[model samples]
Target: MKRRTKKLLLNWRIILLTVFLIGSVVTLAVRPLTFGIDISGGVALVAQTEHPVDADTMQLVVDSLQKRLNTLGLRDITVEAQGDQIVLVKVANVTTAEEADAIKNVIESQGVFYMEFDGVIFGTGQDVEYVGIYQIKPDNTWSVPFRISKSAAEKFAELAKGKTGWPVDMFLDPPVNSLLVVPDSVYNLMNSSEFNAQVPEAPTLLQRITKAFNITVVAYANQTADELADMAEGREKIVLVDLNQGLQSELENMNVTVRLVQRGPGESDHALIIRTLGLYGPYSVGEGLATGQPQQDVQITGTASDRLTAEQEARQIYTVLKSGSLPVKLNVVGMEFISPRLGENFKYQALLAGIGALIAVFAIVYFHYRNWKIAIPVASTSFFEAIIILGFAALIQWNLDLPSIAGIIAAIGTGVDQQIVITDELLGGTKETRITRRSNVLKRMGRAFFVIFASAATTIVAMSFLLIYFVGTLKGFAFTTILGVVIGILVTRPAYAEIAKYLLGED
Candidate 1:
């Protein structure tokens, strides 16, 4: 027995498993696996397009959203399209309700950018060729430099010829065929001198905006449903600024698409204009740009009160502009926030489920074999397989969610079943046959491996489809399941065969 034990420890198959076990531990320590929103608490948003799209268009949508989030330095995020219309956006480590809202806004931002001078469109997101990193200006404002296509540059130069000091309007995802509804107070502010400082030509800013954007305007003043309906007749929707809840609900009852925006305290006039009119800036055309030189480079500048805010604003702009525009707009259908406490509870529950699965498998195996030797090996191998799977996740930094935990359990159960097949093959035959087959351990294990390989292949194939075609949430489950199976086939199952051979004195 001592000789067999010594030989088993020295066996290369056993050593392979031992090396992986140690390596998995060390790798996990170096780079731990990141838990998903289900475990770490974050935001989950469901968005849908107005109409279903083709596979390529859906892929473009996913890529665009992914770029925006990643550019903002969000490391653990998933943006994937389900079917041809719905998209799931998930971000880990977002704990606050406010942060969730901010994420929704970012995801829904179509990133459509355009600039026009004197109501003549000159540039769009398609015109952008390259966007450089943002840098702080001497005036303590952030400026993002970008390059436009030569054709767009030339068009702008020709349009702005001999026309310096004129305002060039910049807009992002501006509404079309829409109406801007402001409260009486906000409408008065739009005409105020203080508001004029932020949005020059303020007294007539609304009319200029109405002309530039071709959007209708109306002010709320105890208007009846019919009056509101008349104003909304030719519009696709109504965008209200600082409007009361009563108006919003009434409009909803009228079957009108309405978007309500709350005006922030001391928000500048342009800010409100950007919200209601989609007009962010009225930047002045420079002499150099108006000289018809066909300048290809331009800068879009913004100022914030503090350095941190300036940096944040710069990154926000950079992220949007760099992502370009989505092929279709996504309307947020649902937003869910998972709290940290709930996340902790979920983690605890996942731990319990994994432990329960281990115990259940061990109990069933022990009853079937009536031997601790066989049952213990099965359980330990299953446990080791889990560690290897986790190590894979850590290496790739895959986010583990509840579905991923379920996949691990499923994989371990499959491991137990395959081990049983090997054990049954070894325990078969009469005394003479058993004696004769002692030297045939490799052949018996090989026979059992045939069945194991078939099953593993089948599971991996199914999960591969899920990984490629499914949404963000299901991808985690598919990935972990595939990882578990691969690890078992390559690492744990072979070692378990060696242990089984040793236990039966086949060595």
Candidate 2:
């Protein structure tokens, strides 16, 4: 009996089963699994394009958005094109309202990028060749160096010839209202000798103003108040600026007045940023345009309170420069922010549902077989198949959302059904057939697997449609279901057949 058991354990089917079970357990314990937005809290947004677009164009839009969102330091993000012109976005772990709003603004708004040298439009997003960060100074303050198209570079060289010592402002959706522009001089000043004392509180100033104020405030770099007039339309716009005599005079001349309110820290809930170009005193490029060489590789740098903030700012700048602008405008039609607590509840309920399903399957299988030797292996094999499926999910970092969990349950049901077929074929025969030769048992198992394989193939064909055409939760369900079916046919079912043959003394 010991020799027989040893041979059974050494069988290829048993060996494969043992290896997979061990690997699954190790992967579950070590790597852990990534959860989707439905399991982990996050924001789900469905934004519709202003008009219907061709399939290829919609795909391009989705791809662009995916690339842009990836630059935002978010690892778990899904951007998929759905329906005629709708794009579905899911970002995990975005719990705070402030973060969600900021992300939403970025997602909904088209990033119109422009590079201006001394107020001349020299390049757009199309001209951006590359963007990256490099540490120039010994202090480890990083700089973002970007290259523009050769044509734009030549144009910049020409336009910048006379204005060698002037500042350049890079804008996203230019003019002013959007409040997304970075002056070339701010980069220098932040890296200069007087940075520590003159920079003010970088944290307090650089943060995107989250406080609610009565009047709308807009910030610009090089653009004058007259140029920003359209941004102030239909709203009470209050312009705020650093205590600059020249900027104040420019605003007065442009008929856009500046109002300075005196308030201590935490005094009121209202705050606005005007971010003037000349805020950091006069600093020039110093006849660098005298070189007049094509300014293809230009470095833009800025200050942040910490390394994390600097990385974020760099990524945001890179995204704006790279993504440029969406081809068509998008308006958010549906937005749902799932709280982590609710997601936790859903996860718990899903677990309970799976447990209940397994228990019910066990009872039904045991009652049908009326023998522990037959029912135990069947139920155990089904349970083992589930573990293997989950292990594969974790190994591949597939997010387990509610739909995925449902898929696992559904797959286990299919597995149990197949296992029952194998058990019945081996056990429920005439006395002569039941006591048949090992070769007969092998033939019976082959017949049972033929039925199993055919069923598995049909199920796979059905789920393939859902996996391909669907984009959201349904796709996940189909994926898990198909994966489970494949594993059942290839791995678990074969191992179960071998084990059942050994247990029934068919060998």
Cα lDDT tens digits, model 1, 66-135, are: 7555433355788877888899998888777866776788777777677766556678889888888899
- State the lDDT of candidate 2 residue by residue for 397-462, as single tens digits: 898899988998899999988988887788746324574576777788888999999999999999
TM-score against truth, every candidate = 0.62, 0.63
Model 2 TM? 0.63
127 in model 2: Cα distance from truth in Å?
Answer: 5.5
RMSD in Å for all candidates: 13.4, 13.3
Q: All models: lDDT?
A: 0.77, 0.68
